[model samples]
Target: MAAAKDAIKNRERLLASVILVSLICGWVAGLFKHHSDIAGFLKQALPGAVRFDSSEDNIYTGLTHAQSESKKAGFVAVRSAHGYAGPVTVAVGLDANGKIVNAVIVRHTELPAFFRRVTDNGFPGRFKGKDCSDQFEIGGDVDSVTGATVSLAALAEAVRVACSDIATGRLGLLPIVKNKPAIQFGLPEILLILLIVTGFAAYGKKLPANTYMKWVVLAASLVFIGFVLKRPISLININSLLVGYWPRWQNNVYWYLLLAVLLLPVILRGKTPYCSNICPFGATQEILIKLGGSRRQLPEKCSQFFKVLQRSLAWIAVMCALVFRNPAIITYEVSATFFTIIGQNWQFVLLALVLILSLFIARPWCNCLCPVRAVSDYVRLLRRGFTR
Candidate 1:
């Protein structure tokens, strides 16, 4: 009994340590990424425009005006809007006719790769010539970045808010339209629905030799869910849900489908087929283990340690997400690295290490570091407790 109590105490200390380290790392990373001060950001966002010293004539809320030295270049409003991760500030240049001359991102907390995708795909450029009259709906007037839907939507919202404020409050022009909802069903949504239905039908029932069926589902997940759709269940998605950044269900049916497939089974059956049968990364690791022809297991004590470590990592990740209110801060998973091929160098290195290690050990990442596994295990524990 004394040894058990000591083990529990040690586990609690380890958990506390992990949480502290994760929070510190997240704060430091945020500061490092956003080291370019607001002044520098404004300079890049509004070229050739000097900050106006006089604050007497400012009309729009949460904005500062800047104009060129020549006075013929018109004015720009530097404003900010709430984004997925945090505020996304931008400089919206306005012509004499109240039309947008140009817009530039001043600062944002979106993931760097997704932000790059938005810029590279000319997302900001689309704001040019748009005014208060234009409805900034994602599908109607603005095309969102394919993989970075939330980031793109945030950018669009920032531009729209800035432009509307300038046009209505300062320019004395009424907005031509109110905000419109962006909602539509497409191929991705259909595919997700089909996949979820198939998973529930196959795994939710008791059938003989279901192992072959699980293999088929795994292959489909690796191909369709991972490569084609590129929408693997990520820690980011989980964090977003926790932080109330739920994607609009009308436009984000795929997200809804994924969440349902992951959650519904766990709620009903105390486990999800996603981890064991449908996770693309798990499928890849299994394939590698088979091909490498090495099956090894850690000692019982080591395995127990790893299980504790896994739970601790998951706890730390959740705490970081809550503290930072930024999903990107907890993105230690390798799903994006494999599917999107766009992630930090450390993430790539980690992915490589995990794959190499999987040759000798079965599902090493799932056993040692997967937040999803930790969550599943917790849910199962709760179910067992309630049953007892």
Candidate 2:
């Protein structure tokens, strides 16, 4: 029995190492391919440019060729900003007068629906001929896209950063280095921290109000983290961090705080309090089960089969995101469908099925299909390996 257990541990660790190595290699190859594709995107941003000066970095100079003259057309700079899902990269074309001639999204991992909304609402066109120094803030100088504020902000920031690079380097503008922003500790962070602390403090205690407290925490998480903020930790965020696409810490304190809330407990105690006690979607299902007055659990064999399927799907999703270097590619998270009411047709259908099934089984989604649970399980496995 001991030998068998040791062999299984060795196999699991070896498989994990193989997967990690493959992901790194694939990410590196994708970077080279993406680099080759940027020149074409730059040309699209600056159509009149006949040629561009070669450079290894994100900044470049465009040249227009006449019969005997090669004159400087403008400068192009590429920059990326953290979006709702992942990084949004834009290539900005600046004329000699330090005005944006055009800007194009070179690459992005934003959700297709949000990206489409921005494009349909003429978001990029709003930046044309804008001065490089102009504050590209949404709802001020730039128009905001309804239902896509995060995407719009990210796209605008990408363009603004690129323009600032060109303005400071070539156009001789004063550097705009502001002091580092203070941590954004807001209602969301406060609420999340309170929920975690209260939940852990009350767990497994014999107090009469313990059950009631759990429900209260769940309800609060559902309302704030789900409907109001609409920023539940998802696979997209996890993949972003894993692939080195971290958001700005000061501007995204809630993001980092949520990650810590989810990860620290697992790292320290091998317990996942967030998913068990604070997941908005899990709360929704629990509420549905309570209201429907049915709590039928799946048979053990069937439950085991579904658990395996869930882990396999999660692994495949993560691997695809890493290899393609786009976290949003396989983001069919049902939480997005239930909370923000944002997702595709299929996601809505999946959400409906999960909700319907919740009336029969207790947390069908959490028990059978949640990617977060799968990730936590793998993390715990790693923890066990290291502890041993």
The per-model lDDT (C-alpha) reads: 0.70, 0.83
In candidate 1, which residue ranges exceed 4 Å CA deviation? Answer: 1-96, 101-107, 119-150, 161-182, 205-209, 293-296, 382-388
Candidate 1, residues 1-388, lDDT tens digits: the string is: 9999878756756655555566556656544443345555444444545553313443212223343323533455666655555557787766657777678787666778778888899868778877656878777789867777767877887788777777876678886565554675787777667666656556765545566767777778888889987778876666667655665577567776777777777878877878877788888888888888987877789899989988778777766765666665666888778888878899899999999989989888888888878867765655554554
Worst 10 residues of 2 by lDDT: 175-184
Give the number of the best model, judged by lDDT.
2
What is candidate 2's local distance difference test score?
0.83
| Candidate 1 lDDT score at position 227 | 92
Candidate 2 lDDT, tens digit per residue, 298-369? 999999899888888888778777777777878768997787676799999999999999998999998999
Q: What is the TM-score of each candidate against the true structure?
A: 0.71, 0.90
Q: List the residue pairs that clash in candidate 1.
A: none
